[model samples]
Target: MPVDNHDHDHQDRFEERLGEALHQAGGAYETDRRALVAAGETRGHRLLLRRRAAVVAGVASVALVGLGGALLVPGGDDGRQSVATGAKTPVASATPKASYTGDELIGILEKLLPRGEFSSPQARGTDDRLPPYAQVVHDDGKGKAAVAVGFDRVLPGSEQARQTVECPDKVLTPYDGCVVSRLSDGSALRIFQGYEYPDRRADTKLWTADLVTPKGQHVSVSEWNAAAEKGAPVSRAEPPLSPARLRTLATAAAWLGVVDAIPVDPKAPTAAPAQPSGIDGGAIASTLVSLLPKGVKVVARSGPDSGYAYVVVDDGKGRSLVQINVQPNMSDVEDQLFGAGAETLADGTKVVTHKEPGEKGGAGVVMWTADTLRTDGFRVVVSAFNSGSQETAATRDAPALTTKQLRAIALSAKWRGLG
Candidate 1:
């Protein structure tokens, strides 16, 4: 997968906040900061794949991750009770001394679990300068399982928060079940049962619960049948936790203080402002459908609000996937996206085409793209895949639409009105 430096920077901010929170919590658990950052970058890249798939589903308009809150200390007659369902501990204040240490947080998590034998436990405390994380290998006699919890925040009132709790479009996410609920405290929670990968290429089942407080504190918990996220063999019928337990773990009041202790980084760059609004995604899909060659038939399309749209079309041969991105005032990067070998129209529109192997690595799949930038900076780039989805094997010999047809659609005057 390609790494977007801008997105990587955003992920770094999240990691920094998490590390700061862990350090404030004060724990014996410690690891090299460089290793942590490297691991985070790998995970962030995988997450971007999911985020991009969400975009195709029309739910992700803005970037998804952000930072906020401090750490929460375990509290109760017994620290474990504070994390139990219906425990109702008071929300933690912003004082660092009052929060639980990393060791205490891990103990609290262990106590909250059902009867099970836990091994290979790992945790980062509230006082560690690394993102807070806890993982345990659990065996209930039936089988061993892996469960983990992570902490972070969302940009309040942004599309990121909304997408965090929104149930994914089934076609894009391929989950067995998913539900989104609102708590009495006005926090949003979503529980999803799905595969570790969206395409279900592997048998590792992933079940996750995500909670976002009204104030932007975000907590996520995930479990897999295998001991690791990938490669490990499935060790049980399903993940160790039920949906209700997942919710309780994510919303535990014990985390509130830790979230409160996370100090914002003065040196971190402010999130880039949302790009200048673009033409609606639905309009783009509709226009592309309208311009399809006579024999081509549109099968499915995405909504207009996503800034990009795709259509599955068939033309007697087989189904193919064609997608387009529409942007306004993108002249700043025209030189980079369209380099040498580009063609310039009499009207000052620059066009470029490329035939490359599929990005998803689907066998025998090919991608043909047409990119266009007008004199006024309006840009339209279109690409077609020989497969129905980039992640799947090719369903046809080639894209349903030829390169000439794609270029014609990209350069059409109709796109100018979209600006």
Candidate 2:
């Protein structure tokens, strides 16, 4: 329901670093577009699968890798692209596009920033496999902080573009302040002030300015109160850049040139994917609320996120977080999920119940779950937490809903009709 940062397993860390390194490699190199596009699409598919695992399995650390996209950075002193991973060598492209090296982009960022000491600079050029970005630890005579800028493209007037600037729901992403404005040139800009950890488990602050132009150019500027985004103590009261400065930096005209240099992925879907369709998030949320037993009222809820929904309800005792995920064509994994101890209904639906410690690392927190898979390969799982948020300490001894209630909710006829 919400995002949190915690220690990840060794494999998770390896994958995260690999993804970051691959994205940060940049240079003026060329390769067969067809092959690269195929690889990128393959990566995109894997990314989606990982995201689903994060949501369903509560592997919060895996979700921190990043939103799927390439990262572009600056070149070296000799103006040659720097490779972070040294995994791929670019041959030659039959068609070459005008682009900026990582060094050039970093130079622009240095010139745009206020007088300050910069260190730990990292970049990827426009011609890199991933989109370009420039990052550095900047000290503006105050405390050290990390500042970064990145470029990408979105379909104009599409849901992606709109969501790029839309403020997240407070229930899902607790933040200090968020502002969305339209620039005179018809671009959308969002200035967000939030914590690096949504639950305020840590004091690190993250502020960002996201801009999307009418023609689909996207520029994002982000800064942190600490020298690094994670695992660093707070270095200052706030990030080095103010909201106005962040807006100015992200909207800089120089970034537009960088964005224009990025080539459109030939294999990228022009429209949304066709599969995995069912009830909308709004319908799911409405259905969840309706299923709640008496004496409980919804105190907070999530936006319609399609196939997943959550609500925090308060009984006279305390607040609890309940969430559900509905999936179609899940029979392939049914054997792994529904084991020998699982109960089988007369109609052939498999049901399993689990009582376990919360995966989010909240002290004293517990999770009660009800998992079910229909004969048609449709799966519905319902879980309830003893705390209002999985990241916080438990407020009560148990979740407001009993395991039986969760099972009933998961097996409800209402869910079958929706799917």
Candidate 3:
């Protein structure tokens, strides 16, 4: 895909853990359900809980294979229920001692959803993984859609919690609408209406609600106009749930109980990863603007996001989106990123250039990139897209900045002082 190895490394870590969980549970289930579980693992990469620096999907659903079996039964007005089959229990914690069966979690989801005929139900329970979730193909007489809910825990005042509610930049993620608010219980909620494909290659709509409580309980609900997140035809005008309904489903008391059931990871890190002390995004953007070829004017720019920045520029033709990622101590992945055909500067710097189609799926979009690494393991990668936003169709034949201009920007000496 010609993506940065550093970002791919983060995604790999998450996928590896999820793969282990699925492999352990695949044997006990029917083949169809097992496939459903695998689909969820693949879709999990798009969840909003991931690091923004990685450029994953802005919002999506996650499904995981539950570890053990459970007996299903019809339940009250909400939905069906299931009782765990085994006696294996999780370690004790102060949050809540209750455990849930995969079927029980699915039952809870049905209860929260508007009256609908649900099929292909799949889920993971508190006894299975850190973040448990449920998915169902639902039809409310309008059309078939896929609805899901996932639960996890984040530190109350942590960066993850904050980012969970923050709206992603429109330049990076194209969306119809988004709002973040504080609930009565001091929880934060974000309701997002966006496309299933950021580039809008398909008309499928994706709507999501994310709620983070003061006690670290995180619940997210997502629905798609189609029966699947990817590779499915659009089956309706919109997702089955409205913004209000998504809010109600995600904040249900039943979900709080499920989130409470998740076991605490004794080895989990207590804080966010530390970054280079002075690596400021604002400085990076300013430096990029300063290095631009004459006559190229900056139109819009990103805020001071630490270690990442972008600018939309025009040179009398069309707007182009340029972005940079500056990182320190990345020599560990040097071999993986700069393999053969990479150039070496006299000062022990490795440089590589790429001309390829855009990765974000924007139609007719192209991307030009320059990646450089210094002897101190400092890395700077800059990319210029033919379109001002990756989620939109291309507006020009080429980016405002040529590959040589991009290379000059990446190799500029100014980035050294910023970090």
List RMSD in Å for every model shown.
10.0, 12.2, 12.3
The whole-model C-alpha lDDT of candidate 3 against the native structure comes to 0.65
Using all chains and alpha carbons, the TM-scores for the candidates as numbered come to: 0.76, 0.74, 0.75
lDDT per residue for candidate 2 within 1-419, as digits (tens), equals 00011133311221232222223233211333221111111212222212222211111111110122221222222112222222211112343448988777788899999999998776777776666777788999899998888877766645445556655544444567766555545566667787766657789898887777667677778789998777889989999999878877887767887877887677655653333454576787889999999999998775555566788999988989887777676676666677799999999999988888775556888988888889998888878889987667789999999999999998998997778
- Candidates sorted on TM-score, descending: 1, 3, 2
Across 1-419, the per-residue lDDT of candidate 3 in tens digits comes to: 11122234322332222212222334222223112111111111221112332222222111111111111222222111222222112222344547888888888788878897998776767886435777788999998998878777766554455566556666777777765555544566667787766778789787877776667677777789988766679889999988767877776767777877877777665663443353677888888889999998898887666666788999899999987777777676577567788999899999988887776668999888888889998888888889998768999999999889888988988888887
Question: Higher TM-score: candidate 1 or 2?
Answer: 1
Per-model CA lDDT versus the true structure: 0.62, 0.65, 0.65
Cα displacement (Å) at residue 138, model 3:
2.7
Q: Which segments of model 2 are wrong by more than 4 Å?
A: 1-97, 157-159, 271-277, 361-363
What's the TM for model 1? Answer: 0.76
Which residue runs does candidate 1 get wrong by more than 4 Å?
A: 1-50, 54-100, 266-275, 361-363
Model 2: lDDT of residue 177: 70
Candidate 1 residue lDDT tens string, 1-419: 01122134323322332322333334222333221111111211112222445412223222223222221222222111112123222254444444455566567678877888987676655444555666677887878887777676555645556666655543234567655555545566667777765556778888877777767777777788877666678888899899878877777766666666555556533453454455788888888888888998887665444456778888878879887877666676666666778899998899888788765556788888888889887778788888777666788989998899999998888877776
- Enumerate residue pairs that collide in model 3: 78-111
